[model samples]
Target chain A: MRIEHELHARRRSRNVGLGLVLLAFVALIFALTVVKVRQGDLMEAYDHQPRVSLTPLDTPAGAPAEETPAGVPAEEAP
Target chain B: MTDINAYDASPEGEFRDYVALLKPRVMSLVVFTAFVGLWVAPGQVHPFIGFCAVLFIALGGGASGALNMWYDRDIDAVMNRTRSRPIPSGRVQESEALGLGIVLGTISVMMLGLVANWFAAGFLAFTIFFYAVVYTVWLKRSTPQNIVIGGAAGAFPPMIGWACATGGIGIESILMFMLIFVWTPPHFWALALFMKEDYHRAGVPMLTVTHGRRSTRRHILAYAVALAPFAIGLGLTSIGGPLYMAVSVVLNVAFLRGCWQIFRRSEDQAIADDYAVEKRVFRLSLYYLFLHFLALLVQSWLGGW
Candidate 1:
């Protein structure tokens, strides 16, 4: 029968704590990457192609409204 | 074959010892002020990014704290207040503390740059260097004005948080920075007045030890008076509102009154009263800062409504 020494218990706890910290770090980095990628998509999507869903059908000029789903406001008529 | 048990024979620092090296109490204050600064800034930050920014800032603060513990271990060993610290108590090695500080500091700075702006990253790097090299290694032992100058290290977090949101500095952030910077001297001097013996024993040239308690009291009152304009000035900034103004007025009046009382009391009276007033002022200083920041946060929330 093997008896676990008190020192071993302390060491185990230390190892577990360090492991948890590292795991958390990895999770945070992954989450950050996803959020950054999603934001990039939002920024580039509007410029790449016309999004018909974003256009306001009620407007006669076939233009997006002053405050449309795309978040771009209509410019004042010159 | 090598003995696996050999490593266990020698003493090892527990996980909590490593955590203790980070100075969690100071980190909490850093986190709070940085959060408040980020909240009150003009632009909106993504929730995740804001969370990461504050975390990185806290890590930077913690890293500086570790470096401070490593450098000041000698003085810490001698001071009764610090005798039980991780390094002084033999729970953590000096080299380990230094290594942790450098690694954490680097990671925090880099991550902040990637998630926020380079300006905030640079500010965090400067804050770490200022605290670790300028304050801990240089000014702390060399001059009685150590706390006065070193206070800048603690005052930068709110500005950094503001930068994280706006990607640039602003007058509002400057005002917040000044409020903390001016308030630091009196806050620390009050503690120094009551804990003079600790500094005396540790050989640290605190204002109380080098300038005498009388001079230190005078300095506290002087700084307290100087602190009023900055504290009140923050209320007029873009972030301030009626709530903030009222809170600042009351807190400043109470703070000035406390300082005046400390300034008037003789050493004999302080001793007879067991430094009751000095201790009370020190506690009040904590509330004074917390409430000021809290009022700003509430005003920001109210503005949102």
Candidate 2:
């Protein structure tokens, strides 16, 4: 027969609480990541690649765009 | 047979004891104000992200509370009010509290930065530093104006919340911050008025201890006067609507009257009544802040829905 001590019970509760907190932390991080990724296109970040969609209608081809080399292909714009 | 009760002499700390170290009552106020700030801000946060932001902010607040308890454990043991706290009551060790505080503080700040804007995360970090290092370590034991300055720490959560939604600060957030900043002194002084003996016994230099109750009463009145403009002025800002304005006006009137009554009472009268009026005013003061924030939330709901 097992004799369960009060100290052991208290220790078990403490461990359970800590485990729950760690589990919640993992779930929250997962949710945050999913929300951020699902919100927009993966390639939306500026990466020094020129796209015609970002260019002003008035700007001539081969215009010096910030973060983009002059005269990048319009085909790459999405 | 071995004595099963042998371990009872050195009681193992329970999970609740760690929660007690976090000061959940104070955390509730932090959570509410931060929520109102996030909701009233001009931009929208995705619901899930917003939830995470508030959770992290509350964790930050709790971390500061643990650090405060760990630092003030000495005085906490001496004071009637805090003598039963986890550290003081021997349920938790001071070192464990300190470690928990550091770990939680770090996690909350980092997760907030990742889930929200870096600016909001930075604001949370500054608030934790202000409350734990600036208020608890520096201002609390040194001067009569401890709470006056420490009030700024409590005042930062809403700004952090606003930043979470807007990614920046604005006049509306500043006003929300000011509302709590101005309210704290009078609120705490009323507490100090009644808890005077505890402060005296603890040797912490609360205004009531350093300046006497009459002076404390006068300070309360002064802060109430100072508080009205911020409270009323917030109602005039972008977040304020008719409901908020109406509630603010009524609460301010009631608060000013309470302060005036406390201000006018003679020491003899206060003692004769056993500080009943003072206690009543303190109770009113709690409702005063809660309803003000609740009104802000209602105003936002009305405007949105």
Best by lDDT: 1
Residue range A1-27, candidate 2, lDDT tens digits:
998887888899899999998898888
Best by TM-score: 2
Q: Per-prediction interface RMSD?
A: 2.6, 1.1
TM-score of candidate 1 chain A against the true chain A: 0.50
State the TM-score for model 1: 0.88
> Once model 1 is optimally superposed onto the true structure by TM-score, how far is the C-alpha of residue A41 displaced, in angstroms?
6.8
- Docking quality tier of model 2: medium
lDDT of 1 by residue, A1-78 (tens): 998877778788899999999999999999998999888633233554346644445677755344433444434322
Which residue pairs come into collision in candidate 1? none
Tens-place lDDT per residue, model 1, B1-305, is 98777776465778999999999999999999999999999988999999999999999999999999999999999988899999988878789999999999999999999889999999999999999999999998889999999999999999999999999899989989988998899999898777765776677788877778899999999999999998888888889888999999999999999999999999999999999999999999999999999999999989732
For model 1, what is the error of residue B102's alpha carbon versus the real structure, in angstroms, after optimal superposition?
0.5
Share of reference contacts found in each model: 0.62, 0.83
* C-alpha RMSD values across all candidates: 7.0, 4.4
